[model samples]
Target: MQNTRIILIGAGIGGLTAGLALQRRGFKVSVYEQAAQLGEVGAGLTLSPNATHALEAIGLGPDLAKLASRPARQAVLHYRTGDVLVDQERGDLPKKQYGADYYQIHRADLHDMLARAVQANDPTAIHLGHTFLGLTQNSDTVDVVFKNGARVTGDVVIGCDGIKSEVRAQLWGRVPPRFTGNIAWRGLVPMYRLPPGFKIEPASAAAVGHKHSMARYLIRNGTMLNYVAFAEKSGWETESWSVRSEVSELLEEFDDWHPSFKTFLAATPKDLCFKWAIHDRDPLPQWTKGRVSLLGDAAHPMLPFLGMGAATGIEDAVVLARAFQQAKSVAEALLRYENARRERTTFIQMASRAAQERLQGGKADGYTKKEHKNEEFLGLFSYNPATVAV
Candidate 1:
């Protein structure tokens, strides 16, 4: 961890968070993002207590409060009648139980905050428009080649690109992410656009119907209402995130739901409606091959039922950095990091799959007990990435 040059392949939340954590530990860090301009393409993200603890450890605690929404409670409701199924307080419970606060924030807001922090540490740390083509390594350094015919060398290379990662394809084979026949519609509506008496709770909430689910929450300090609706559909050929759909299509999907939720969807503009298919890959047997390793979606892409996709990636960043601090060499550090993370991430992935099945009206075996009702989230929420052994 002493002044070794580290190259991160993607500038996403995982990549940027790893850069800052490595920089703070006295490592020279450089982040390369494929995009010409950095941005996020989602409505909102749920930062549970585990992720909040990791961010605070990386010194983003105060800045997070200023940019995120701390929902007082979270609830699950019946899709037709609006009856509460599960309601749990979040304000002080997370702090008392997990030693951190749960947060909901616009994805872009969190991305920008991390980019600024990385810049504030070193202005030239992040490089834009640098697409990773391939890499070659000897005994000491890895030489990374970009699409523009430029090469850069570093002591270690970390791949945070995403599910369709070039690094993963180059190191392993071209394994495609499997689509689970689930399509989701997402949009954000301003608070002022809602009609009178259409009350949205000041908490992260989800309503479940037959083979469909709708989640609504606030972001940017309750000024924006972020909504995501999911249903089973077939024949979605496109895999890109920029796929646009009609607002009427969205309305038809949720027409039988509660009226309050329907009113909220009616306000969404046609141009603002976005849809994407849910895709994930099975957990890899290994994340590190020599000096290179995968992180975030590249390592373990899971369904969003538990909402820990980004949070688990954040955990990878912290634990990987800590492994570097405790180990004697870079390879040893990476091995230690993988040993610490693989089981936890794989469990979450499988649990997320089961939760998705249940939500889609599969078997209802383990969802009855109070403690096991939301048990998949407890292991994720209670983890502390900084102090966990590596």
Candidate 2:
């Protein structure tokens, strides 16, 4: 495996995890990112046991726990009118259960941790500001072309660039992102400073106003409350991150809500609120093309409802690196990766879509929050790349 030289695009969780896992598997890996700076603007993510197992396999479990919260207890949901819809328990993870704890973390904190691990484990790794534009590969080697007029050679290339992946373009002619007719509004507020006399739920770091199709969570030791509000809409010209949105306009969407929810909206600063039109893609016929393939959102872009987008990508990275270690050729590794992951990730993508629809007041057969339990994710959670066989 040490003879393998892998080129990974995008320095997100998936890419970094792939680097750590491959390096641990005796494969040489280098990560590239288009961002000039490592700053990521996003709220916390719930890393269910499946993702936790992948992170632990990469050797960052202990440190990640320190940087994240495990939630004192399970979450309770309401329909914004103060009617309880679901009350579930948390914390029954076994040693070999999912192979890790269901850790929750701020996106930036998690990325920084992975970046630090990538650099520390291998000093001369992770090239920032190197944009991936194109690539070409012969039978024995691949040449990755970048926007900076530089070229890097490797044995295999993994695209973790994201939903609007350049690698996907390089593989299947230009496939644009499809707007899923949903508009998302998100903001973070200080918990201690939320409006005075606000009667908020106690188990709430965040809460969901089901009537408005919104959800919330907390980060930074429960000091900051992460708020996510959504509604059905259509046709976004561009699906890029960080779209501009006015707070006044966003607040209008929830103006007539419950007093507590309105109070929560009132406390959000104008500048902190940003909005984007949500999107996702249909599963591709194949994730790999020759020596180049996709990972993370590049492979499967799911709604954030289940919060498994990044987690699934992390799992893909670990499994891919392990598959390469076990297979005799890069082609075999590529095939093995798709074989081991396609169905599972496709299920998640479908589940995420189902969850989004259900939350939007749409009903469908065989789709229930009961089936999308924290335990169901344990299938992907319990997978450990070090000892994984296929």
Candidate 3:
């Protein structure tokens, strides 16, 4: 493995996780990111047992626990009435049942932790501002050219560059992702901002209504409430996270909901909000082309309704590392990685789409069943990438 030099494109969760895992496996890894700096701004993510196990395998469990909040339970609520539709215990129950706990953490905190781990393994491994331009490879090695006119070479290139991946576009040509007709407004509010009489339970609560939904959960050790409200629309022309949204617009979208839900939105300290239209691609029949392969959103992007998007990416990193551990050659390892991961990711992709439909069609109960079913959640949560055969 020491002779293997791996190049990872993207500095997000998937890329950083893969860098750490590959470094631990004794491979030389260099992570290149298009961003000027490594940071996750104004977003949140849920890490189920499967992701927790993967992070623990890479020795970041203790750090993650400190940076994240564990919800006592996850409940689906009536969007207009705030009534509980379904409840699934989390916290110790998930840890007891699946050997790892479910956690919600600010995206920045998790990304920072992963960056720290990668730096500890190799201080100079991360390169910022290296936008991927294109790549060319021979039978034995690959050369990647960046936008800055810098070129880097490696044994294999892993595309964790995300949904609009340059590597995917360069490899498979530009095929645009289809918009799911849903736009989401995301905001973070300090817990102290809530009115004194307001009593919000410590749980991951999803308020579901006709063609709209809002999920509120705690992050940053319960000091901040991460809110994501979704509404169905004809289309959103811009698919970006930097788009500013007015608070009034957000309020108008959910005006008919429960007063308590509205209260949560009103409690926001400022008018700042970020919104993005959800877009996903049909699963590609293949995730690999020659020595280059894709991971995370680059490989498969899905709706956020199921909260498995990042978790699946984390799973990809671990399984990819496992594939390398067992296979004799780079090509063999990548093939094994895809063979082991494609089915699971595809299943989650379809399930999340189904869940999105159920949520918008006034049948969130169906999505809840999909979430609560032992076979569905367990089959996903209980997967141990460290030991799973690749």
Candidate 4:
């Protein structure tokens, strides 16, 4: 089983982590990515203790600590008045409760770390520019064909190709992802560019309004601040993450927001503003079929309200490797992986949608910490995917 050849579609965070974890377990792994080069877009991601624990299990604890920022606290504030509605201590609390530290890191940094780790294990592990076209699996082996006319046969195939995965289309038939009637604008600002005395007290803050909200947190070791603003909208349906939006348009959209929001928006680089439509899919009955299975967004894409998208993907990678280690055969391993993950990921997917409504349904003035349904409050951080029974 240690010599089983695993072919992974998509070289995103989940795919890379899976490749690395399987390699560490002595499995011959190959990761195929659509892009010619390996890199992640400029954005910030929260690594809850659940995700941090998984990364630590894969030997990235030191590197993650170096590249990520640890927020001492997080708060939810009123969008118009800037009054704190919820304030939670985070510095040593997560470590004490979950046995791991919560971290905020640049997405690119984390992706690069995982990619490099996978490459270090086997220089030929990651195959670039191989767009996954489709696959054909029989009783014994799975054959994945790429657009570049390359066909590789492996013992097992895992699709970590993201929400718009071709692998998923071929497996489950094409089903359009449902747009959640929400649009988001994102930008990054250098901390030095902000006005003097500008502070993100509590380190991470989310300003909630009626049908709209904005969240910001420090990343890249406190040198950069990442912010994402959300608003309820309809009809506009382009979901590309690279779609640029005018800074003036963004300012006008949030014209009635608090003055501090405008200040942070003004500090953001005009060329760096981008917007994308949020989309998610209903939970599937299963993630595995024969020797092929799905992971990450490909398996269970969810709204970003809970900030657990990437964390769940990371968790999947760790548990998958563990499943392979314990199972007797490829079929057993795939079944174990899906059975272990389906219930949890499904719960998170549904809860994230509920959170979006709770946070943005009504006016922010009435919001309170007691009513918060965030990741920590939901007991999501307590899951150590690395040690969970798979």
- Alpha-carbon RMSD, each predicted model: 1.9, 3.1, 1.9, 0.9
Model 4, C-alpha of 334: deviation from truth (Å): 0.4
Q: Assess every candidate by TM-score.
A: 0.96, 0.90, 0.96, 0.98
Clashes of 2: 2
Misplaced by over 4 Å in model 2 are 92-99, 196-211, 235-237, 362-389
For model 4, give the 10-residue run with minimal summed lDDT.
357-366
Q: In candidate 3, which residue ranges exceed 4 Å CA deviation?
A: 364-378
Residue-wise lDDT of candidate 4 within 309-373, one digit each (tens)? 99999999988999999989999999889988999999999999998877787658678876777
Tell me which of candidates 1 and 2 scores higher on lDDT.
1
Model 3, range 117-175, lDDT digits (tens) per residue?
89988899999999999999888999999999999889999999999999999788899
Model 1, stretches more than 4 Å misplaced?
362-372, 375-378
List model 2 lDDT by residue over 1-390, tens digit each. 558889999988788888888887778788889989776677767787777778888888888778876654444344345444454444454343556666667888988888888788787888889999889989988999899998999999999999989998899878888888888888877776676665444433323443346666566777777777877766554565577677777778776555566676678777777788888898887888899889999999988777789888988989998899889999899899888888878988887887664555522223235633433443545655445555
Error of 3 at 290 (Å): 1.0
- Provide the global lDDT of candidate 2 against the true structure: 0.75
Count of clashes, each model: 0, 2, 0, 0
Candidate 4, residue 371: lDDT: 76
* Candidate No. with top lDDT: 4
Q: Count clashing pairs, candidate 3.
A: 0
Please report, in order, the local distance difference test score of every candidate based on alpha carbons.
Answer: 0.85, 0.75, 0.85, 0.90
For model 2, give the RMSD to the true fold: 3.1
The local lDDT score (0 to 100) that residue 178 gets in candidate 2 is 82
